[model samples]
Target: MKKQQSQWTHREKSFSAFVTGPLLSFWRQRQERQFVGKEGVVIRYMRMTAAAHKKAILVVPGRSESYIKYPEVVWDLFNCGYDVFVIDHRGQGLSGRLLDDSQLGHVAQFSDYVDDLETLCELELSGSRYHQTFVLAHSMGGAIATLLSQRHPSLFTATALVAPMFGIVLPMPEWVVERILNWTATRPHLREGFAFGTGRWHATPFGINNLTHSRVRYQRNLRFYADQPELQLGGPTTHWVREAIFTGRYIESIAPELHHPVLLLQASEDQVVDNQAQDRFSLARNLAGFPCYGDHPQVMEGARHEILFEKDEIRAEALQKITEYFLTFNPNTV
Candidate 1:
């Protein structure tokens, strides 16, 4: 706790030497569990527990992501001496798919994610005693996690949001996109169909992919989907987009009302979510005399949407910040 975890460098090792070998091995050792989510959906999640641990960290992954994509993250946090929990949100990961087409990502309501998460915590952690509990969420999960914190004022001690999906980076203005989505969201077929230019899951080439600059990490992620097609997740449905947009606005509207502290890390080169919305959330909270951790959204320059899985340097920085922040709430950190 006195010193920060060092940022990993690309010079460290090759793919098989690290990711496929140790990371994969560690990932398989996690306890796999499931519970019935809203509407009979089977929600799955993973947990790494320590007998004498006094702290716990729950990881909330982004849209189109699974706990399978987070072994490295779980390993890192677990080594930091805290229990780690990662959930596969409904409609993605090993969880039950809402739509008939398993690839298409859709949710009945954004709040359902929050509901499932709360239920999971109640079923799993309610009986445990962890002095400091923290939430590390990314993208859409960030929105979900925030809403969870809002509903239960004392569930978590603090939260870390990495490139949260406060708003989607649309081609046109917000009002125009809103009008279009709203008109179609109520329709039966169109509402559940793929939104705009998106479609079923496909492997985006490394060169053209905007997710991460780290070829190693990106390729490893692709390896997961290629090996197990069940893990592949595609674009969001029209209803999903509608829910996300409206929920993002509501999150900003209630930014000042969050009871627990939050650390919002924004990616400078992120092309998925609108940074301006993050700014608005941070500003709103600060103006209300309740600022986010570090007083504003922390911007990680040259980073893409997936900071936790970005290049070594960027990912390391994010991990260090997250580790330090969670440790700050630990009475024995020193």
Candidate 2:
């Protein structure tokens, strides 16, 4: 899709000054639910439905993210005429942890995340045939969504990914990283420990943060962790990192077979996931005649890794594109 003056001008008016009182009210409206995931772990998720029930959007968040940080996003999509659902993966958010230390982000296998999501769809979204369902995934959740879509192609109408983590922007070369991961494999003592340059959950100062430029949104999100310290998540484990790399390559290999259409939104100034990987995925989809991220390079100029929680101007543009893209699947409805 080309950037243009979308009909969703009202969305651009400004929800940046997101108030706590109203956000809290919106949070209260959601139905807190949980289900048994892979290995008998209890995974949590939230559901916020609009009265019309015309359409639905699944909000798949990035690493260290929780539903509590999505009041604004859920509010926007619901107002735009769709119900919203958000899942907390096995090792993060409100879900159960694999390791004893709640701060360590460890998982037995990445497929467990994909399996838990598929189970949720089979259960709570049992009547999903009544309306079209779309996915809004970001960062690590992006990989999980990709796996889910490939496994169940007919489950969702379409998918929109924001800053999807197709690959990680590592601190060192891939060869070196692979060697390090291999070394960890031989040492059980280091396998479950935090990766280099990461540790217990702590707030990064907004001025030097690489996630987003919106200080207000940044500070507001920090408060959520402060108010509920249990929601705080630290770095990833060596096992998790190994799984992520394996899953990412697998997704790229299978991109050409993805049945549903995808709209990927990239952050130009991202210091997180590899942009080149996103491009490769888009190219792979296009090879199979699927419409992927249009006119690459700078999808969102000067934006950081957090596109959904970006400044008003950047976030508004992203929301507009997503609204238009999802509607393309059923143009005559809503």
Candidate 3:
């Protein structure tokens, strides 16, 4: 547990030196602004460790996520001697919001995420003093990273996915529901507007409760949200869900094209995304005609979708596998 030397000003509290302590202090330390893309979308990002390091990792968060949500993970990477860069994707956190006139939280395609990623890699990595670069993506970010790795095979040294939302374990039949929604949306676009899930403005204890393996971590996350109410990005819009289904299906169709060495971290008890699909995809890739694209699959038992936010020991083990794999198979280093 490394003590954070800088006092955080956001929530009027000092952060604990331990890796899994309160998040307000960490969030306060990372409230700086950085520009991304030609439009200067003002993506909020935080960098850990100023000393030039040999390797760097760009962390992408899940849907409707803010950079403040993952300070512990960033700190872990920093302590491991890797310079870390984390950004809030467009329409989330402090990045550019969808136009007021348009549907709130609407992202028409995942390719938009790819564009953002490409800009960050070109602008940040190209100018950085680090020697090697990799991507660690979670959930929706995992899908984006997979697609990006395939499209720009030479850009990243490797990619690590934590509970990648390749597909979801929906309570309802996914294909049937998706087809029905898509069909309904075709006739009257304006009439098709519906909020995703229960469109509640406040964070649900149930949602945050199920996120971590330890009560301490869950409580810490809750306290941060208590201070910064704006950090709570409720549910996805109907349009956003529709877009996600479309993007997810499209990405699934293109998995065979990915050429980078990928490390897929699947949680045994993941509730949000389909664990079975993750395992299936990994095994299918190994059996698929393209042997180069799939080989490394690491499963962390007794973990949830938020694997990095789990108890300290579990999180450490998961990260160790990632670090080891990247260090071993990184194309840029080898």
Candidate that would win on lDDT: 1
Best by TM-score: 1
Residues 1-334 of candidate 3 have per-residue lDDT tens digits of: 1132122111122234354355435545653556664345556676665565778899989877777777777866765667788887877766776545322454655677777877777767885477778899999899888778777888887788898987766557877767766765655453234443534345557455556766656766776666876565555555566666666666666666655677888888888877766666676566664432236457788887788777656776777677667767543442
Q: Which stretches in model 2 have alpha-carbon errors above 4 Å?
A: 1-17, 293-298
Q: Please give, for residues 1-334, the per-residue lDDT of candidate 1 as tens digits.
A: 4333652545235656877677778877899999998999999999999888778889999998999888888988888888899999999999999989998899999989999999988977776588778899999989999999899978988999999999998878878888989899779798899988899888899999988998888888898999999998888898898899999999999988875889999999999999999999999999988899889999999999999988878888888788878777865753
Clashing residue pairs for model 3: 3-17
Candidate 3 matches the true fold with a TM-score of: 0.82
TM-score of structure candidate 2: 0.93
Model 1 spans > 4 angstroms off:
1-4, 10-12
Better of 1 and 2 by lDDT: 1
Q: Which clashing pairs does model 2 show? A: none
Overall local distance difference test of candidate 3: 0.68
10 residues in a row with least lDDT, candidate 2: 1-10
lDDT values, one for every candidate? 0.88, 0.83, 0.68
Tell me the deviation in Å of residue 154 in model 2: 1.1
| Weakest ten-residue segment in model 1 by summed lDDT | 2-11
